[model samples]
Target: MEELDFFKSPDEFPPRRGGYGLVHVDCVGKRGYTNSALVNLYAKLGLHRYNWLEGTNFELDSIMKFNMRGAASPYYITLVACLPSSGLQQIFQVLVEEERLGILDLTCPISRPQGTESSKKESTPFLRPHSEPVSATHQDRLLGWTKSVIPWPSSEIGFSDTKRFYMLNESELQCDWISLYVELAICTSHRWFKARDLSNFELEIVQVAIESLHDKEPPSLKSKAAVIYIAYKDLAKARTGEPYHYQAVVRRVINEATGTLSIQGDCWIAAAATA
Candidate 1:
């Protein structure tokens, strides 16, 4: 089963920072329940401690948060057993095909083995060889596809020409809990969609612009929700690069859902280039 591959890396573990982990189940109906079941199963298999609270199993979260001091290494593998067995297999087959087709070229480097001469080599390349670069036309096509798929607030949904942009699939979007992953992708490509820093007045102006444009027909429910969340979070972060304040504003806006529907931030004005 496709889920078998997730469990195949017995030594692999999750990162210390908390993030979403994809889990496939034998059946669509079992997806939610299997999350808990697998936790118990793994714990019983001596994987780690398991706890169930209010019918929610947190085994995956615990394992991902596990820290090993000194010689101990935490195991952080996330497994999902998907159902309609054939359906799961088909999804994986498509993914593998995409990888082979160069449709998905996202890859990262792995550290060399410790205590090895190769590890000591200064000029050794860590990334996979034969990696291909996406052409500008391909990037434009991808961006256009993303714009078509995700309904923006309106034509007036102004994006900074200075910022970079990126397109993420549903799975990849979900895996990026903090949104840093997406930002990294954009920065790597040297494209910008949102500015990283702005004053409170600048943030207010952007929010007001968005609110002014929001009166039009809303996008699909998913798109609308995502856009709202993204606009607010990104705006807040742009004004203040700190997470705590951004999250506080997010929580406040979320709590005052009605008022939040309307923007009440600072205003924006053009700034001159500094010498």
Candidate 2:
């Protein structure tokens, strides 16, 4: 069921950093950042290592700071997987598709190998090179996999506790998680939405936003939510760039709003009782 002619050139393909490319951001803290948030995010997704007497299965390979040069983006920590057997290719393929489909939350796209222009043009829908290695670009940093050897199953996250923004389809969705991923996508696209580049990710976010805006809640609440979402994103890029403290401050502001909501709920209840 494979397309042989599509794989034209008999020439050997160059080596790849074969494996799953699960991308995550490592928000550098005031001092040193920790990978705990990253590890916690993974663990929340029900991914853990099985340390058997015979051998280990499903382990963390590396967590490195990638070269993601974006305005509001934080340093990336790529979590590589050392599978039990050799399903690296399939895993990578699925991860790529999931990221594209917005099933998994990620800030960057999967990296392609170095290859010639002709071969790149002939690359499949999944961007797998047919002939030579796909050419590497600056965007490769977003894939979270570079050639590095590190110890597995690191605890303590990092020296400093890190914060991660991940969303897995299998888990219950978070309002903030959805907004965060959408805002990140908008930022990477330079805040411009082009239909040509719009796909499942774009469509999914738009659908959610629309539904949120049109929910049974009051119109004022919906408008306020949208305004807050936009304002937070704008503030993230204002002056300080993206820092842990900055995010913490923003989070406090958000929590204050949440607190206000609780007060409002009490007031509403009282008003109803009087009525």
Candidate 3:
């Protein structure tokens, strides 16, 4: 036989179309052995919490063994943006209820230090100048009301910055007048639905509540509710992409009756005015 070149033989390429070759053998082993083992392990562990996880695992297995050759992994990215506050609150409530029912373990630990600090702070008395004891007198009662109702270390909600406005009343107004206004504001916010909206419905509720307030008798003129002339105006302003504006009044209502409080007549803004 003549000398043949071993390198030139077609068999050197391992017969690309043959059965059970190295490439086929490796692929089959990965799919049947390694990939299957991983899938089985994952299934046994039950780690598929979300739909994305299960889908991702399936894609990964198919790609690794070249069974369904494509991308090496499923690149999935989800972006949730600008969730509404109301929806967020509902979700939080659901989670809390679930935890309460023992559907899920509590993820957060209770902090004893914070609890202790709060308790200690509560025990300390607030030292305000001329802090007279609260009494049946209008002044004392008003002071007492402010201290008890208003949260200490007040934020924007407290209207603490407007404490001067409250104090300025001392020159010309009585404590009952101030107290009644504060009480009305606080109670309406606490009792009514969508109180923050201050819409027509809220205004009606507030009016009714204020009318009810006038039924009570105060010891002095200073203690009476201020006669307020409420005027709702559209200054055409938007806060955080929401159409809102200065819903205002000409004066604060202190003492009033079922009949409307008269301001310079032009001061009152009713639905008719808005229309």
All candidates in order of lDDT, best leading: 2, 1, 3
Candidate 3, which ten residues in sequence have the lowest lDDT sum?
89-98
TM-score of 3: 0.17
15-99: candidate 2 lDDT, tens digit per residue: 3466223233342332234333322232212112111111334444433233222232222223344554864411110111112
The residue ranges of model 2 lying beyond 4 angstroms of the native Cα positions read 1-59, 74-79, 85-108, 111-275
Quantify how close model 3 is to the true structure by its C-alpha RMSD in Å: 29.1
| Ten residues in sequence with the least summed lDDT for candidate 1 | 90-99
* lDDT of each residue in 152-268, candidate 3, tens digit only: 223353323332222232343332222223223323223222322222222211221111112243222322332222222233223234333212221222111111111110112
**Can you give the lDDT of residue 210 in candidate 2?**
13
Instruction: List TM-score per model, in order.
Output: 0.20, 0.20, 0.17
Q: What overall lDDT, based on C-alpha atoms, would model 3 receive against the true structure? A: 0.21
TM match of model 1 to true structure:
0.20
Model 1 agreement with the true structure over 44-96: per-residue lDDT tens digits: 22211111001122221222211111111122233332233243311111010
Off by over 4 Å in 1: 1-4, 10-60, 64-76, 79-220, 223-229, 232-275
Best by lDDT: 2
